[model samples]
Target: MTEALEIRNLHVAIEDNEILKGVDLVVKQGEIHALMGPNGTGKSTLAKALLGHPDYEITAGEILFKGENIIEMDVDERARLGMFLAFQYPVAIPGVSVANFLRTAINAHRKAADPEDKGISIPDFRTLLKAKMDLLEMDHQFAGRYLNEGFSGGEKKRAEILQLATLEPAIAILDETDSGLDIDALRIVADGVNSLAGPDLGVLIITHYQRILNYIKPDFVHIMLDGRVAESGGPDLAEHLEEHGYNWLREKQSKATAG
Candidate 1:
């Protein structure tokens, strides 16, 4: 069977400045992989590139989803193919209600899959949205409010996870979901992710801190540095990073460069 997402020797640049230098990764269904790195190390760049963000140009390498190269696909095309990205900083749409936004997205996906379909009915959409909101422990009022408008940090993060739950993407890339969140908020977000993790979904969590891993244990841990993935290992690698920090990885990279 084809893998969920396979990135081979991926290279990305923005405005002629290369950010991701030959990144190779494979995420299979039912696995969670954490890409941990320091600030400005191209972690977020990698996430954006995978989602086909126009700003980050993919100068080289291939991104294959389910055995087909998606490097040339557009952002909406990729999303329609069951790939979802939860942004590090989610933008607010002042006039769009959360319920309407979700319904439109869900209907788009449905239409893409079956061109003959008329889209989800209002009654069915409400039931589905309510169930997803309950699963995420969000209030019904959240659905009626404008998307991410005037939401607190915790609320924003929760809203992102709610999108993930509602979309049910095959591969979900959460870029720094733990950023700007407190302990309680972090746990809630983690719980939301944990609930959705199963045989049908794969997750790529890009983060700089190991605190989130304490709740959402990853099956594999990777460390990116200087625009490349320097090391990869099991969950213990995250524990090591938590205890020591990135100094060891930096020293190792320095020696490799000097050699």
Candidate 2:
């Protein structure tokens, strides 16, 4: 069966403040879904909850991945199950080299998948890393640098992309990957994402603006309003949002609530 990530009536909260009121969505492998909304609408909260962040508690509902419930799983467990979240602001690991960080991660994944596995050999890892880097058109020297340490905004995002590539997760939640990027940087990052899109991955891109969507066309667009999904449509929805802001949707929502 094709791997899928399903969120049904997912209610998430941070401390006492509930953020995601009731979110329901499904992303299957080979699909690109965009979750768009203004600030404080719970887009990022949903991403965190999906990945089992301890602070963002899942008060209710179910999260199913590949036909298995993941609500009770730990963060690393969820990652091992082929779920990944690219943060809006990636933190720098000063002392860890990019290659070393990724190698460690891959080894962990290997150990999880099989207890008998000793992990990939260094020569084999280098070969795999080089292949992935070549596919992303990155220089070998880039791997020797510290992970995200003293890197530019574009380079930071690039490192995330490289992580995504190496991990090869079935479902990826990109939380505002377009933030802090200039036009050129955004294009390069989007190009990297576009190249990696295929039947093997299901991508959920969470963002507040349409600037990045112009480059990475989404198969589905969802709009969040006041902690719930108020609307869902094709790529035209994103275009409509760009053309005319969320006021119209807000008006419609108000009407529905009044009735």
Candidate 3:
């Protein structure tokens, strides 16, 4: 079966306020698409809704994964179905070690895929975890630390990317992964993402700035404005946004609305 994520005429609302006004998009495996826009344009809302966040209500629309409607699927169910979201701010789990959390998650996926097979053995799990950590350039000791607890901003983001690496999802949505990172940290995290980009993975990178694109070049660039995609083009479109900002797009959207 062809692996793809398709969003058709998605409309999302938080509380009584509608955020995403009719949005449509499709992401296939082995592709990277960057959704860029100013704050409050519902970039994050679209990402959250796609992942089935309870707070964001999907007033109308459909989210299809592998040609199946997944709007009703629970978050864990989506994760188990090879969908991942790397949050902008990773939450701290005070007691759970990174290794423990990943092992449990991996086992859950394994068991879901096959009912009879037992979860990965401890030694084997450790080896697999270590290999993934190394692929992300993370130290072996990093797994011993509690998941995101007391981790620096960089560490938290890197840990999120590590989870992405280990899970190897078919579609990964990065919600502002570059939100809070220094130059070095940004490069590190971007490099980690770059390393994981391949035929098996399709990534949706949501960001406000074009800086992150410099490292993980997107195959298509989309500009979101007022809860809808205003314009979309190749990498050059991002460079245009970098130089002119979103004012032009906002004006264009306004004119179109008036017309």
Model 3 alpha-carbon drift over 4 Å, by segment? none
Error of 2 at 157 (Å): 0.6
What would the per-residue lDDT of candidate 2 be over residues 173-225, giving only the tens digit for each residue?
A: 99999999999989888888898899999999999999999899999999999
lDDT of 3 at 249: 86
| lDDT over C-alpha atoms for residue 125 of model 2 | 94
Query: What TM-score would candidate 2 get against the native?
Result: 0.97
Instruction: Write candidate 1's Cα lDDT for 112-181 as tens digits.
Output: 9999989999999999999999998999999999999999999999999999999999999999999999
Q: Looking at candidate 1, what is the lDDT of residue 242?
A: 91
| RMSD of each predicted structure | 1.0, 1.0, 0.9
On lDDT, the leading prediction is 1
Q: How many clashes show up in model 1?
A: 0
Q: Judge candidate 3 at residue 178 and give its lDDT.
A: 95
Candidate 2 global Cα RMSD: 1.0
